[model samples]
Structure formats: C-alpha cells, structure tokens
Target: MADYLPRAPWTQRDDLHRMVDALGNAPDGTSLARWVGGAVRDGLLGEDAADVDCATPLKPQDVMARLKRAGIRTVPTGIDHGTVTALLPGGKVEITTLRRDVSTDGRRATVEYASEWRDDAARRDFTINALYADPRTLEIYDYFGGLADLAVRRVRFIGDARQRIREDHLRILRYYRFQARFGSALDSEAEEACAELAAMLKGLSRERVAMELLNLLGLPDPSDTLLRMEQRGVLGVVLPEVQRPAIEALPTLIGAERQAGLAPQAIRRMAALLPLSPQVAEGVAARLRLSRAQRDRLACVAGRQADDAANPLALAYRCGTECAQDRLLLCGGDPAPLSDWEIPQLPLKGGEIVQRGIKAGPEVARILRAVEARWISEGFPDRERVLRLLEAELPA
Candidate 1:
C-alpha cells in the first residue's frame, strides 16, 4: 500500500525541503532525514498536520551541529531522547535520531540510537503513528500496516496493546482520544488493555491527565468516547467526582452548545461532568490542577444556577456573560442570548438615585439596588426606563 502511495502535497514546500537539506545525507549516500509520526499520519488522511517531526540516524549532538552549521537555530528539546527542535521559516519541526527503547517504565523510556528506521518505528505507541515519508521522494514508508489500519480508520497499538500501555500509561488516554478523533469504533483489544491498565493513570501527573482530558473534551463531540470511558470504569479512576448524573448531563450540554453555536470548551464540559455543588467543583478543578481562571469558571458554573424563566440578558448581566452561558447550558436554560449581544452594565448610577429625594447615605445604596434589580429584570432597558424606576423608589 505504501508503494502505491503518492507524495504528500505539504512535503513539497520550500521550507521543509530546506530543513531536510540541512540534515544532509549519511555515509551510504542515503537521505538522513524522513518525515515521521503525526505529519505522515495526517497527510495520508488528507488533513493538514500540526507538527512535522523528523527521524534521522545521526546522534542528537550531530543533528544539532549540522543544523547549527546551516545557520539554523536548534534547541535540545529532548536531547536525551535524541530529539531536537529545528526552527524553520514556516514552523518548528522536531528532529529526533532513530531510536529503540533501551528500557521502559510506565512514564518514560530510555532510548539508544538505531541506524534502521524500522527499529525506531517499533517503539511508537500506535500503528498509524509509525508511518514515515521521505522528504525528497515524498514516498510513504509503512512498517507496521499503519496505512491499512488508517484506511479502516482503526487505531491499533504497534505490538502488544498491554505492553504498549505498560510502557506509558498516557497511551491509555491517547487511545480514547485518537479513537474519538479518527476511529468510528473503539478497538476492543486496545480498549481492554486500557481498562486493565486504568489504575496506572493515577501514577501520571494530574497536569498530564488534565491536558489529555481537556484535549478529548475540546474535540467536536467527545460524548461517546467519554461514555465508553465511564462504562469501562476509566473515567471514575481519573475523576471519581463524575457521577451518573454528570454522565447523563454531558450530552445535553454538548447539544446545547451546538444549538447555541458556542464552541466546545474543556472547562465547561468538565463542569458538566460533576454535581452542581461549588465545593465539589472546586475540589475537582484543583485536583486537575487547572489554571486559576479555569478553576474559577468551573466553580462558578457549579455555584450559580441558571433560571430558564429569567431573562437571558439579565442572567448574562448578573452572572457574567461566560459563566452565565455555562450555567444556562448546564441547567437546561437557553444560552443563545449572549451569542451576539454584549453584556451591558447597569444604566443608572448611585449619583442619579441620590439626586432624586434619597439622601446621600445607605438609603441611596438601598434604592439603587432595588432600581438596578428592576432594570436588570426588565431586560436592562434604556436610561429612560431607569429614570422612572428611580422616581418610583424615591422617598416612598
């Protein structure tokens, strides 16, 4: 299948050609670099790849020194793992020496450089990720039936599914994410291995877990994959806070987001997967090690309730535009009101209320609060309406 494979259009770029040329050739006169991993995988799928990584037989220092000779900047992003970052005119390309895993823990691998491309391919997590392409000929090299699996839209582990997951627990999450992004159905063998190794996820850093979950949630529709995770007892392991109610709530939230034309958001989805208790939400967000703003958003979504009968404008005004939208969507209310409309501030000021017969004291604050509530409840009408509200509250 690889032989019949034609060139990837993106490989024809001048910048990419320059990067390959800078890597030079081996003593055998063969090209030292080939485009590896996601770039090749996505190119075959006819979608643009976000990253274009390189594989070479040269050592890490050699990769760096050669790029340095060509006046190309390089960073030893993962030097120990034989990886370097090449800054090109178009974008950053990762250049790593061909390597085989010398040893493996659930977290990381110690690698030794290998001269053969197939040996390097053996260490990768998935079959689809192991494909490579020549920078010059643009011919794809599929070592482990990657093109076959990809043709069928199947995400398969390279060798043994359990062995692969044991090498890195993160691949468990990655399996689900890739399945959601590319596959029509989960690979049963891969799913079974992931389920068996689910407990290993607790060993991974919360930040890593959070990142993968968020990436999954950021997809167009991750509800099915998440449900599968819950069914397999994986979601409960990672996020014990997620209950059946949350499991049921996510599809509704996703539907509301689509109906309201709001983009899928990770934090909001995370909020939906927890009970509507601010304290529980706060604990979950903290456990995920989410950023301060994200934590606050989750807590707000949980803490505040959205009233479907309440005016959308007033909700957006009172709870803030973003939080209100999240709350509304979560609590079965309409979130579409703020889609085009900006939240407006209260039109009347305390000074205006005081200028009416109300004295400059706490009385002024009380009257303003009543008038502002009226203003907001009345769909935040113009100052003309606010003036009448202030008049009615004045000294009576």
Candidate 2:
C-alpha cells in the first residue's frame, strides 16, 4: 500500500461508508467490493470525482436486492458485465461484480464473476484505471502500481499493448484521447502498439470511431496525438476522404478557441477545415452524435464560406446572433464589440405588401429581396429608411 491523500469530499466518503456498511450485512455470496475506472483514478489525481464504480461480490440479482434494500435506486445499465448503477443523493455509482474475461471478440468482453479484485484489475485496460479504493478507510488499493504512473503522468496499458488493442479496437482512439487529456508524454510501446494495429480500426463501427475522434478533438491540446494517429495510418483508414490539407490545418483552426465557449463548436471549427458538402457535413454530425445546434452551425459555416454577400442585415437575418458572431470571429472581422452591428428591424410584412395591392407570388418574395437589398445598401439606419425602401419597391 502506498501513502495516499483523502482527495474525495466528505460527502463522497460518507456515501462510500454507507455503502460499505450496507454491504457488510449482505448475505453470503452477496457482499460488495469497489472496482475500476474514473472514481478511483480521479480521486487519486486530486480531480473532482464524477462517477464512482465498484465490484460487488454478489451476483447481479443479489446485488440488485442489496442495493434496493439499502434504498439505492438501481439501473440495469449493463447486466451482462454484472454491473448495476446505484443511485445516491449526490451522484450515481456503478457497481459490478468481480469478474474475469471468459471470452472476448475484440469488440465486447464476456465476463465471469469472481470474488477477487485482482482478477477484475487484471482484465481492465489501463493501470491507472485499474486502481481501486476502500470506501471505509479511504486507502487506495493499487494492484498495478498505478500510483507511480499517476505521479509521473505516464499512460501505460495494463499488459501487452497489442493484446489490449486486439481485445477492443476502440482502445486505439481512446489511447490518443487519454494521452492528450492526461498523459504528459506518449509511451513508445503504446505508440508502436497503435501503429501495428491502426488498420484494425476498420473493424470497428464508423459511428464508434467517429465519436471517439470527435471526443479526441474536443480536448484542449489534441494536435500532437492527432498527428500521431495520422502517422499511424489510422486517420486514412477511418475517414479516408478527409483531405490532408484540412488535417494539417487542425492545429491552427482548433488552437484558437471560438467564442461560443462550447466543445461541440470547437469540433465544428475543426470539421469546417475539411472540404465537405453541406450534406456530407450534416452526415458527419449525425455519425458523430453531435447535437443539433452543432450540426446546424457546421452547415452554416460550410455554406457561409461560399456566400460572397457582405450585407450585414442579410448576414444577421440568416445566421442569427450566435452564429453570426462566430462567423465574424472566424473570418478575422473587426471585433469592435458586438454592439456595433445592430441590425435594423423590418417594420413591413408580407401582409402589408398585400394591403398595398402587391401580388402575392414569387414577385412578392422578389420585391421583399429588393427592398432588403436597398435597406442593406443604405446602412440599415432606422425604420424610416426601411419604410422608404419598402415603398419604393412595393408602390401601388
């Protein structure tokens, strides 16, 4: 055991103790033990805990009963892996029974429940993630010297890198994401492992690979790791049509954070670097599970590049406030504080045109466009200028 600090909050510690106490009364073959992932690693790294995961000695049914008796709501998030999500006041904890891989098809693992934490730790992906914590004492259980790796900021696979990559090809993308997010330096062994198995990424679903790539790009500094993936031939294999020029421009495009202050928009900026059609860009958004706003913004940015119209009112009306601002920022337009571009509102409507005896056909739309053009050219001053333009275009 290594010396560790109490990085978790008092509430989290109390919750863990409550869980352990409840498990202490569990019947034979229904006990609980803590196990892998973010909860343990983030705690040790002094980062805020997001989700807590555990391993129960109890079988799935038994674990459900015990957690229910303890008044914790249980969700069958993944029963196949003997995992149950126990909902607590502050957050939810994922508790899985100790298991060893019975079989794996390189995409999913078939696990067999065991009572030993060591067995479960051996089956995990990375050393740091394999670390477990004792809720009662707040002491970390390090079966793989994950503490040492954490201290040095190195990311290493639990065992053979190739074997791990072969087990799940998604780990290929995850490796770079981890390196970019937490790991200070990339391990040569890990890099070589990825290079050897880069083509295996083709075996994974495009949706899964696209999600991982989007997540990797969302990181603060993903350029180096992305470049590494590119060198390993993974990029070409996964998104073959994505040109090299855009890939090369990723560093500069994503380096300056956009003003939206959202990760998905940053992702859109990176995607915009690619020479893709609006339809292809929309497809990419759907493939990556990007939110609707992200999809719309990406389409708008792609379309805006081809539009040569400099009319402020036209730009504002089409792009809306948020996207218009984002576009101006990206195009190196003057940042004279957003207040300077107040768009003049149109007082006249299609109803007003009809009242003025203007025919309601394609000509109605044409006249409106003409009126807008004159308004835009006149600096879009006030309502008077707008009305004058409307009158000139739609006179009875």
Candidate 3:
C-alpha cells in the first residue's frame, strides 16, 4: 500500500514531521500513531483535506506523556473517549487511542480503550473512514476494503449497516452526506438500513441534525441525494412540511444557480427545496433550532411573493440582489440581468417630509412609504420627479 499511496500534503508539513518524530514509538514498544479517517480518505481521493486525525495504540495518559516528554503541547479534547489533540505550529492533529464500543443507546456510545487497531476500525461508520496511514512510513493500512471502495467511489457502511445505525442514528444522515460528496451510487443494503431506521433520526438533537442536513444541502447539487431521501421516506420523517412540488423544483433551481455563477448556499438551497411560507419556514426554524441569523434569512426569503420578483429594479430595491436572484432561481427564470440592477435609496429624506408641513410622527413614515412606492412603480424616476410625486401625496 505504501508503494501506491501518494504522500499527502499535510504529511510534508514541518509540524506533522516533528509530531511524527516525537511520538514514533510508545512506552509499551507499540508503534505510536498513524494518520487515519478523513485525512487519509481524502488524500487517497486526491483532495486537500483540512482535518488530520491519527490513531494510536497507546493509552490516553501514555499518549499525553509521550507528547509532553517530546516537548509537544497536548489537549485532552476527548480524553474519556481515548482521544487527545496535539497542537503543532502550523496545525493541530487529533490522536485517539484504539477503542471498541462497550454499549450504545442510539444517541450516545460507551467505549473502552483497546490496543488493537482493528477494534478502532470496527467502531467507525464507513469503510473509507477506517483506512489508516503510517506517518512514518506513508503506508496505508486497510483492515477493511476501504482502498477498493475508494477506487470506485463507493460509500458503504462497515459491518451490518443496520447494527451501525442502531448504535448512532446520526449515521443515517451521515450516510447521505458522505454519498453527496464522494459516492456515485447508494448501496442497497445501506439504503435499506437507513430507510428502516429513518424514524430514529428524531432521537438525535435538532442541532446535530441541522448541521448535517445543512452540510448535505451545501453540496454543489444535492438534488439526486435529496430525491433518494424522499423516495426512502427519510425526508418525510425529518421534514414533513416539505412538499413534493418543492423538492421537484430543485433541479431547475440548481441549474439556475450554476448558470448564474452563484455559489451554493445552504439556506437558499433549503428554501428552494421546501415550501417557504412563513408557517412552514417557522416550523423548520423551530424544528432545526436555527440561529437568529438563520431564522431571519429563512423568514426573509420565505416572505417573498411571486409578484415581488417580477421586475429587476423592484426586486433589487425590496430584496437585494442575492435574495431576489434566489427567488428568480426558484421561479425557474433567468436572473443574469440582476447584476445590472442597482438598488436606489429613497431620494427624499424623513426631514424633507417634516419640512413639507407634515407632522413628524407616523404621518411622516406613511408619506415616505407612499412616495417610495410611487418611485418604485415609476421605475425609480429622477429625484425631482420623485419630489413632485411626494408633493401631491402630502397635505395640499
């Protein structure tokens, strides 16, 4: 495996080199650590990976002691889970001792640290994620058929898919998320397992579910995966409020997004994938425990009506370019001219309304709204024309 595996970019960094040099051998004469999980998986796929996690056979305390003795900083990020974070100069790497699941209640797992790498790999969710790379030798250790799976871009769960889902229901969603990024086809066994356990998703926290769902939605085009989720009844359990019509609109909306050169936005994509009425959006926000910003964005995009986006300038004035363009995409209309549309501020100031002998209370606001509507309706006429329109709307 070492002969075929290319050295990942992170392996060349000085910090990783020193970390490897410092912990090459453990106290019990076991090999110290091997780069594992996403870092190894992505490197083999020829993608630049940010997180570099490692697996070690040493106990947590011994792992800490070795790093400390070698003058490396250590953080007990998940000590009870046999995990330690080694902070290096250029970056940080998470190193966890081998562990086997002792018990699981769907949402949480209890584990006992073990020295066997196979036990660690067995506990992982997917075959690709179980691949390990020796930092010292650049050799990939594939206890499972991870190398074969990666070669064909398959995203299958390790062991019995149903049993894995029973341990952590979140893997149900994770199955789709990983597929959205790396897989070409869904495994029938994994799909059946996920479908059977779809209802169990509610046991997971709203925040965790939201984060994973949003990650899935953030892919360049998640239409196919989303459709599969819908077919398997997963979407009905997760978001019953979403209708088939909204899900059907995704391909066109995604096509519009690509044509307009717009980046994938999770919230906007979410909006495109559901009925964006206030009540439904509110339900989504509450169910997902969305943040204030996320709630507001969803609400704002949901509040838009079809007529509001009919005109480019009016859309720009009311919703801003991004929001209006998203609406246009949702409507299956071209939004290329949006770039040429500029949002113009109301030419008349509040003081001007007051100066016109109008009381400075709600009357002033009323007159400004009236005048701005006239300005928008008239295609944002010049300031003088706007003033004349304002003159007629105010007290004679």
lDDT of 2 by residue, 156-178 (tens): 88889999998888888888888
Candidate 1 Cα RMSD after full superposition onto the native fold (Å): 2.4
**lDDT at 246 for candidate 3?**
75
In model 1, the Cα lDDT at residue 70 comes to: 82
Say which candidate scores most in lDDT: 1
* lDDT score of residue 194 within candidate 2: 87
Tell me each candidate's TM-score: 0.91, 0.85, 0.90
1 versus 2: better TM-score goes to = 1
List model 1 lDDT by residue over 59-145, tens digit each. 989888888888889989989778899988888989999999988899888888898999999999999999988788777788899
Error of 1 at 73 (Å): 2.5
Give model 3's TM-score versus the native structure: 0.90
How does model 1 score by TM-score?
0.91
TM-score ranking, best first? 1, 3, 2
Better TM-score candidate (2, 3): 3
Task: List the pairs of residues colliding in candidate 1.
Answer: none
